[model samples]
Target: MGELFNRFHATRRNRRRFWLSILIFSSTVLFLFLVFFVKRHEQKSLSYSQVEPDSCVRLHEVSGVYRIRSERNRGRIWFATAQGLYELDTLRNQWQRFGPDQGLGSDKVYDVAFIDEIPWAVTRRGCNRYNAKRGRFEMVAPGSKLDRAPLILIEEMEPEGVFFGVDGGELYRLASLQAKPERIPIPDGNDDARITCLKKIGEMLYIGIENGWLYAYDPRNGSFHRYVFGRPLSPHAYLWDVVLFKGNLWVATSENGLYRQEQTGEDTLKPVKGFPAKGAFAFALEEDGFWCGTPFGLWRYHARQDAWIQFVHPREKQPTDFQVLTLFNEKDRLWFGSLENGCGYLNKRNLEWVTAFPSLSRPNAAALAADDSLVWVGFGYQGGFTNAYSSDALQKIKAYEASDDILEQSIQCFTLSNHRLFYGGYEGFGYLNMATGEYDHYSARRFPEIADITDIAVSPSQGLYYLAGAFGVVAYYADKDSLASFSETRRYRTTALYAEGDTLWAGTLSHGVLVIDRKSGQLLARMDGVSSRVMGLFGRPDNPDLLLATKEKGCYRLQKSTLRMESVDIPDKVLPGGCQQYENNIMTAKGMGNLFWVGTRFRGAVVYDENIRQWKRVTSQQGLLGNQIRAFAQSDRYIWIGTYGGVTRFHKPYLSRLLDIVL
Candidate 1:
């Protein structure tokens, strides 16, 4: 009985141990299965979150004026700036801007015309009509005949008709934008000639061609006749403007000053006396006198006195030498639009000139970088630098000429890492420690071959820094304070560099991309599937693959594991489904979460949605400063765009999602 009881107890203990082992094994297996399932689902259904256009897109611009127009009463002024179209509230002294979201056809507005008190504009793309009731510029349909050509000039004709001229010197009359335009014949019959200006008086229409040709048309007779200036004007002279003032016809030329003739008597235009010899580019008619906008200054002519008075403010440090491009007159107020400085307003009663929308002399922004606290923009060549704490206000950062450590004044590229701001230029590379306000510089003397530092990349984990320029690629050891050659291919010019973990990718001007081992500076591989001129490279935040930007070839994705490259087809309304022809010259690229942003040479920036597998392009049509993008940088809430015109900060909530993963 004792042996049997002991055997029963041993059997029960063995059974319990077996069940315990089975439970442990099953639990482990279930946990592993759940992990695998979740990861797989996450990868397959990766969310490239999107923000609403209203809440996501914001533009920060340093107001650089392009043109200006005023109302008949001069109570309100509209400024066409490098940034966008702005309406100045004279009473409040503030500006209200209109952009793509507000219905602008394009943010880069070249000229504006008022038809029936409604503002219509000519942009880089075509013509747009402002619909005040809808609060947006209604874009003309792409199928319209006008869309086939670029419209450069727009003017309102008599009896509720609009007249517009295309770059090909084709003039069309539209009774209403909804209706098809009626083609008007030119005297020269040269469809390739560029139309520069147009004016109307009584039953006659005056047309100015860029090739120093002037024509007069009679709407009643439907006849075109060329106007002779009687003087030998250069064949290549540009006819800037034409105006009908006080029973006289006035014409402005780019090379040969100004000319005037009687409205219906003179067969030839006579040179206007007391005019600037260099030429007048713009003209405005006044009740008592006429205003002429010249390259050097503004000239006011009194018809009664037959005398000229010039307005200049060079001694007062004002924009006296501003190349006036256009002028508007309202009662006692004279508004002058400049090619460089912003618009100038003169109150004839007080003889006071107030320049509105003051801007940078040269705002050719080339490099951009931003953090949550500040945004930095570097200009091209000798353009200098500027920064802004708030995107709404950009202020110039003074040059550190007082410090001998500061070598290059013009910045070409910028990178911000670990509170250190790194800048590269034609001369060398330098860094500014943000926390300590300490600055240091390095010159080509230390790295003789690197005469110009085109790009800089940092690998914090390895404490390594890489520089790419005319000399190819070079690596620097922070601990040893020494530099070594990463690539000896000096013949191939390097344009950009990106560092990821133990790998460094260099984009060459004509040799595609080079992959190097950061640890040993070994050439691991070469990617040449795309065009030879690789403009930029960006690493995937979640994967080892890279997104490559190329010139004229669009973008491509390089798979790290397979070493296979495939072109990314960007679809557009004008392109075929598989075509990559819409703005293929990509300049820069950045990745945020599963979304990729590509900056192009002419088409602005494109945003790719990985989840939807679609792309949306943002340009001047979409409120960007300009289409020519130079560089891009991102912060927690904004994507900073460096453009040829200026820097634009795009507010993106998706960046916060990326920060959540990183932090």
Candidate 2:
């Protein structure tokens, strides 16, 4: 009987082991199938994220290089752009930019030159000298005679002399930094002509003027001679560029070919034979001969071949020949700048191209964000570039150019969450993952649908991105990868939004602000007396308990917890359009002070200082890039102003301290 019981127990144990092994094997097979399926799906969208950036969005390397000045003695190279000034750091091989924030007279810089190792910038507003010790610019403060006259040109000659041309038909010499400017009279028949080019060779100052006139003047002996070009050009063709190369005088003309000095007795210039005209504009010298930049392409005077060689042709490599504005010989590289977007250098040793300076790929810098080592910018709105640039030593990381890809949209704001860049634009709202670049924007193609986001904001503490406009307020939770939108009221025409700890401030089209609770989706408060079409709403770093709201007509300060509202202190001299004008739904500046900047259309920017309780207006009258403000980008230490003219960077000296207050 005991032997029968043991045999039955052993048989039962064997059956249990058989069933357990079968179940384990089936589970393993199922796990492998699911893993394979998920990975295959991820590969299609995420393959390029680890190795490269998107092919649709790329680093735009051009920002209109208008002038170049190399202060070799100080190992400093200065580049003038349509926006502002850039100083090349040879040690790091990077360009350090300076604009209106650095007290520059204007960002539309006409020329940049270093006299006596001190950098001087000339702009449409006037001339300014860099005070290295102060780390800013001081306007060559208008003297009594100038009377805020617009500056047309500046000329610097050897033996410690700098000359400036004013619009009142007067030439003044600034003897020294301290001495007052003294008027230097020119010869007869020159008052009405616009000076185009100024070249000083030995003691003779060669002056080229528009309306076909050239004058050679001697400042020491008061001797001068004037000549006019009657051939190869119209009577009004401006003498563009005059340079002394290979011990001979060469001049460039916009109408036809280059003019070379033919005889010692002839003050007249004759067009060089067998030279390609191509609308010569600027000159850069090489060891053998020289290079002339033109509207058509880049032409080099091959001294060995004695023929003009077309080095870079337009349409050969994506519209390179769109008017080469300036060229320079820096070390072993030949640097050339274009009228709009072609600014780069050609390596003489390897014959490769390198574009420097991290400016806008297009005209308007719509939005800006920083991710680790890369700074990303999105271009859109009026200028119609519909492009963006991510810069790391000016590499072409990605490009977004096709009609289907661009869709002519403009990015209004950007916020990063979970390694993804969430952007809102006039077109729509989308997120760009480092692992997944957006494509076919509206259709999306395997990606999630982009929200209808005309404007948006973010809350770092809550890990939430707030989406407004048409759909009301939508909160995207980054951690859960989910979206929670409060679409109860579609009537909320939210023009601006600001998210604090537990509250979200939404400024609407009317002169009212709606305060909402983040957790409950409850309407907390409502305030009135704000300007219509509320444009700006944000919490200040200095006072997190208060909110600042801006509108087309004026501004108001609101209490966060109590929902109290008050009118901002307006300075009498803030130029009629600022706190009192309608403009800017943007961020402000920190670091230097509790500073808030309001961008205007005609007035550059109106700034309010919380600490000092004061206001000041900045414009081209001060040192801005342009008077027409289009867009704005704010980083940790800089506020970027994008205008119809160009872009400018303003520094915030005390940004670090502001964080301490908020924390």
Candidate 3:
């Protein structure tokens, strides 16, 4: 009996060891899975890069209005925009913004409708309804069927619900905010199923789909009738907008222009004659007339004379209010939203003055320069305009006169040193006396070789200004007021410039950096092995390695001691579905403290901390107007980023928490 007891104890001990081995194996597998998930999900290498809202302000107001509606008794005006929904208190004149933070399904809200004074929005994320008391949006849909919802229309008749259209030709109705979405069958006609606009005419519902097709549905009969615009539509043709005016139908096509149907007409839509633009974007109905928003501007149709009156933003031209996208009118106040300039309404008789002003908008911020007291934004392309604003309030300081000759050209690059703002662009290079607020511009006539300047650098060591562009590298001595051209780099296409000691680094299109002596204006040696297409360069007196930014290629650490360039490894991603097109590009880079901030053409920013040798990436998801970054300007407390869409300012103190993720 003793022997048997001992044997049983031994067996039990063995069994315990087996179970422990199994547990250890399972834990190992689980740990591996978690590691893979975190690396894949968050795109984490060293740390993460999502920042809180307080850290950044996307000042560009990415507000492209798609639809505008007024809440009559509520004294509220609702606008569906590209970024989010905006609610304006017409009485109190206050604006309340509703975005993803406010529980919105998505930021891309295309249409918003109010039923029973409650706002219902259709966004790329799906259907959402506002809970006013809670001040947030709640999702109201079955699963994710309403995902990619773009157009919404209210139903006043029986069923008393809202009809929303999804991108995949699927339409759903919500009988009540709390109820599930019911799918409504839609007739197929166009190849593209994405719905663009929706309008309700009596019991018949008009649905405009992409691909230039319109469908009219009668709820009573459960039937759909398809109508088409004249054939041979452009390859990019699509129905942008539709409206009912004077018992007739009017529709706008993306590329084929505007179309209209007579009160008693055929299934085919005829092109609107005398319409200036080939593409009309939006329409708003008035008492007897209708307003058409087009690429040319806003046109108001007069019933009496059957003519159209044009109204555009006075100070801007083609790139300004010329491309009117959305319009809405309330009595004498005509609200209009352009492609860039947020949204504003025009009073009666405001149309005439628009003719005089011609509505050319402020030039887009191509290059940015800032100091303690002021920030100067320079525009290029359609003639340059230097706008100076107070750093405290960001209010424009009308310091330059309209007739200034410098304002007539585009400013491609700017170099601010010693209160002298040196600008270079299509005309050549010029200097604006920031202290005196005086404009002293130089045209191509001043120096023919400096024309079409791409980049300019000021040599603090030698106090000489160097130019690199289409005409190649040139030297200008401010003290002597002399210009010298380097014949060796004369035909070479230079892109960027950096001054180090007495040597000037000029990045070329394909030849690499042209290291030249600032005093003699002579080319030293071409630094090869780096990118043939270098963009921007950042260096410091203490740092041994110079950070070289290149187009499409990641940055490199060029050792000034050895004159060798080495590539740095950039992770494939930092977030899920993020930076798919990231080529590890560092289009422009600037260094401050231990951090180097670089902007990409696609991604908003990528920050590197030298202390930890780690990096973080940020994009539009982190509050950027647009991802195509062009320029950057930094102050003590704020860092400004200029993109094709607009400028973004980062509050440095608050931003540190998000960017300081490495160590």
Candidate 4:
């Protein structure tokens, strides 16, 4: 009886053990399957920021307008309208604008002129004189309350001084309209006529009046020469503007194009075939010719052929599109200020249309890095995507499958370990495979939940991945099948994370920085008492410290849990995105280098020089299809820049430099 009872007990024990084993195996399989399924799903549904237009140019006011007075060029047209002032570069297909925002003044610019080497701008407040050599503008008006019109025609006149034709066909002068312009009236025969335009030649000031009458006032004698055209032309027609070119007086009328008379004695006014009938209003002097502004467009008077060459508004021939409001010549190009479309540029040689400036859809990106054949980009609030760039012969590949994950993923930092690429985003920690475009499961649903992963670091010694999120830091060991968690005294938002040697560094928005010992998983040091919240962190080259770029505090270096402030200053510079450490060098992958590069959200890439401590900016000036930098990677010697526009390469210097360091 005892032997039979013992046998039954042993049999029950064996059955229990077998059932337990089956349960354990099934649970393991289910966990692995869930992780795989989540990762696979994430790789398929990726999306990016929606592209849209933000603002428009305000009409009725000019933004930028001025005369470029340089050594080779004199009195080139420069103008500022509400849209912005632009310099017409005829050869190139663009316009250049300058101001206080671009560096100018607070008053609205109305007119610009040059006298000898001095330049002056007329504003509603007063006349501003400029010393171009010193790049300074100051109000030089002798008084206050100046007129709204440009009346001076001298080669070297004060900003506040102006000359004009009187109503009586005589010449009058006003000194410093800003201070209350008082007219120095010159007596004339026709006292009821209105003044039109004025010009100064040699020692005489020529004035055009409303009755088609012309008068030349000698500054020496204060006398006038009443020159009137014969009855063949309408005597009541008002004259527009006048100029002296090649020792001849060129008269512009309201309806008639231009009439020329020689400077020699007994010269007669004759109609020139070169001038167009009607439309021509303002006159701007150029290097080789004089530019005329009309309602249709700008016209250049070629002296050799004695003909007017019109450069109409640049467009696709939609007659009702944009209307030419004003025109100026800057450098060598003709700037046509428009009513609807901001502005237009005309090429000098071919007189063809170039392009227009458009608003940016997405905020620019910062630093971009690639490792293990995958690219990582750091952005804000909600982070972005990843892409792949192969250097050899420009192998273009998307870093993360766009259709794999949710469209809007907040990724701040990313790193690579062995064959896995990890990302620290807003929601959770995630990884991707190097060989196949596959992702590992990401979750914040586990116990001690971790949401908003700020930075990521990998332990080369333990082959473990460290993720820093809003709550604290978590370490995941794939090989050992172990996971450890570390919590701070209080919940804090992590900003940047990195690992150097055996120490791990995590930066936070409000708490400054946290340094941890890898083996013990213990907090070693806390870098607090900083001016602003930390935005990025990077490991210095060949140094044990990390670099932190703050929200408003420029940049600082942290070594051995010690803080070292940096002296670098960015001028009119705003740093975007976050930072990353790779191969002993620190980098900012967001839109901060050179000028910040734009790319795909998943894998925005940035190229920079450690020695120079400068970032690469992808700009239209550099021939990049677009500025959004998504992913970046280095293969052998080549560096690839993956962007929403497409993948670009910087091979020669970049590839050659890496070869030296690697081999």
Better of 3 and 4 by TM-score: 3
Candidate 1 C-alpha lDDT tens digits along 1-663:
999999999999999999999999999999999999998667534431232334334444423354567666657777775545777667666566665556665556766777878787777667777887877777764567676356777777676477888876688888775687788777666566888877676667778897678887776667887878878787788888888777677889988888888555676987876675577788887777788888777888888998889877443355445677778777777877776556767888988887654333245667777887767666657434444343433333332331245435666787788787787777777777767887777777776756677788888667677888887887767668677776555656787787776777888887788887877777887776655567667776467677776766777788776778888777764223322455546666666556677777676777776656677666654345678877787777667777776666655644334322220
The lDDT of each candidate is 0.69, 0.62, 0.69, 0.51
Residue 579 in candidate 1, Cα distance off native in Å = 36
Task: Specify the highest-TM-score model's number.
Answer: 2
Clashing pairs in 1: 103-137
Give one digit per residue, the lDDT tens place, for model 4 in 1-663: 999999999999999999999999999999999999987665432211111101101111232322222222533335544432334443443334333322233324544555444555544334456656665565554443233333222223343346443323433345543344445454565554666656566666776766577777675555778665633356566666677776677777766656767454434677776466453455667656687755455677878776778665645366434445445455545555555554546667677764333111112223245643434443334235443433231122443322457322566555666676676655667667666856665667663445776666666566788777667787888777455777552366666666777777777777888777877777887878564656556664365545565554545655563465453433223225332212111223332222222232232333334445554433322323344444443434434443444334444353234223211
- Model 2's TM-score against the true structure: 0.57
Tens-digit lDDT track for model 2 on 102-204? Answer: 6665556767777877888877667888998988877885664543455656677765478776654566677677777787666666775677776667787
**Residue 13, candidate 4: alpha-carbon lDDT:** 97
Better of 1 and 2 by lDDT: 1
Worst 10 residues of 1 by lDDT: 394-403
Q: How many clashing pairs in candidate 1?
A: 1
Model 1 bad stretches (over 4 Å): 1-67, 71-74, 81-83, 262-264, 315-321, 358-637, 641-645, 651-663
Residue 584, candidate 3: C-alpha displacement in angstroms: 4.2
Compute the lDDT of residue 215 as modeled in candidate 1. 82
For model 2, what is the alpha-carbon lDDT of residue 51?
A: 20
* Model 2 spans with C-alpha error above 4 angstroms: 1-65, 97-101, 144-147, 167-170, 225-233, 263-266, 313-321, 349-361, 368-377, 380-412, 416-446, 450-462, 466-476, 480-663
RMSD of each: 22.6, 27.5, 13.5, 26.3
